[model samples]
Target: MDLDGLDALLAKLDRMDREIEGDVGTIVKNNTIEMTQKVVKNAEFTQGYQTGYTKRNIETKIVSNLVGKTISKSEHSGYLEFGTRFMDAQPFIFPGFYNQKKQFLDDLNRLVK
Candidate 1:
């Protein structure tokens, strides 16, 4: 091919390569944003589950302890104090609590993913 023609072809190829690179960069950026959003959403969900599980567990323990101690139902306002103390004294209760929480959270996570 003539030198002028060869040069023009090379220039066109360079422009095409630049366009392809730009497209690839856009795709990567979009994917990265999507991935980041998903991670944030998952983290929020996990935090919510942990908070709710802890609250319910505390309530249960307080009620159980108060009843066991023969505290009058009229005097106890839902056993909040007892629950807090019981949970503080026993850390292993968390695993069983989390296990029950996991069933619901796992289903939610599966749907989200």
Candidate 2:
């Protein structure tokens, strides 16, 4: 049995693993920022001038190499997203998040393959 071929395969696998480690963080951060931008751009308020408050508060946070988040800092963000008995939901977060999430997963799948 030739052990040389096995060593080459293992070395190639190691290099591929390192490349993936580096790419994962970048992928997460990019997707998170894109999602935040989408949310901010699409977050519409009936009050025209007040729209800046919510858009300005929407931000992206990189938690770690493998994790990231899009946060809405405005006090009324939840109300705007989910709405209440008197108000209909003007959703901005979920649609943006899900769209980016799907692309993120597709990117990961491509990387793995």
Candidate 3:
């Protein structure tokens, strides 16, 4: 090809490259924005749920322990039970609270990646 024809072809190729780069950059920017919004929303929800659950659990345990202590002092003072049963009952009462919190954290980690 002649010099002018070759130059024109090169110019066209450069334009195409720039357009592709611009399109790719836009797509990446949009995806980043969407992912950021989702992460923020998930974090807010997880924090709210965790805070409420923790507060309630603490309150319930405090009340239950107080009542149990009072009962033991009054009637069942002689035979007091302590150890695994009392400790194990907490996880059971809360269901999947601990596991769910762990899973939420794991999901947040994945989102960061």
Q: Which stretches of candidate 1 lie over 4 Å from their true place?
A: 1-4, 47-113
Position 82, candidate 2: lDDT: 86
Q: Give the TM-score of candidate 2.
A: 0.82
Candidate 2 local Cα displacement, residue 105, angstroms: 1.5
Q: Residue 62, candidate 1: how far off, in angstroms?
A: 50
Off by over 4 Å in 3: 1-4, 48-113
lDDT of each: 0.38, 0.82, 0.36
Cα lDDT tens digits, model 2, 78-106, are: 88788889888788889898888899999
After superposition on all C-alphas, the RMSD of every candidate to the true structure, in Å, is 19.0, 2.5, 19.1
For candidate 1, write residues 1-113 as lDDT tens digits. Answer: 54668888999999987776565444444433333333333323332235444222222211221121112132222332233554322222233334444543454354345
lDDT per residue for candidate 3 within 1-113, as digits (tens), equals 54668888999999987776565444444433344333333333332234443222221111221121011121211211221443322222122233344554555455445
TM-score of every candidate:
0.39, 0.82, 0.38
Highest lDDT scorer? 2
- Is candidate 1 or 3 superior in lDDT? 1
